[model samples]
Target: MSSHRRVWYPYVSPFDPCPPIKAKAYSTPPSLFLGYQPPNLEQFTPMEALKIGTLWKVFYDPWYSPYEVSTEEDQS
Candidate 1:
């Protein structure tokens, strides 16, 4: 018979007893590898502006400011 060694990995079963899992708080936000940048609004057309504005209204906080109320009326 040829001499050979066999290795075995410990098998974990569902019925096996496990220690209690502890939750850890993160000090910093997780990093995202995706190269994502916020959209630039200056290049948007009137139609595109309206569409984006409508969508933003549904959320509690919208990122972009489409309009600003002026205290003084237009003299023109």
Candidate 2:
């Protein structure tokens, strides 16, 4: 079954993480997971990371986000 997170999804079928908020879905195309190079950690400034971390902390619920899980938005 298809899911609708937003009323108007900009990208057609095969898009993932549409920008500031990247919510992964099962419908995501296989190509996305095929050897995708993760963003470079070296370029991230401390402040940038801190901001993202704080946003992620609030975005996810503590119960769902176990202390061990990495901060990837598992929308699916």
TM-score of every model? 0.17, 0.19
Task: List the RMSD of every prediction in angstroms.
Answer: 23.5, 15.9
Task: Give lDDT tens digits, candidate 1, residues 1-76.
Answer: 1112123345556676895333422222111322353464234455765775533221212222124422222232
After superposition, candidate 1 runs with Cα above 4 Å error: 1-41, 54-76
| lDDT (C-alpha) at residue 14 in model 1 | 69
Best by lDDT: 2
Tell me how far the alpha carbon of residue 47 in candidate 2 is from the true structure, in angstroms, after superposition.
1.8
Candidate 2 lDDT tens digits, 1-76: 2221223234444555444323432233323333553453234455865755532222322222223443334543
Measured on C-alpha atoms, candidate 2 has an lDDT of: 0.36
lDDT of 2 at 2: 25
Provide the lowest-lDDT 10-residue window in model 1.
25-34
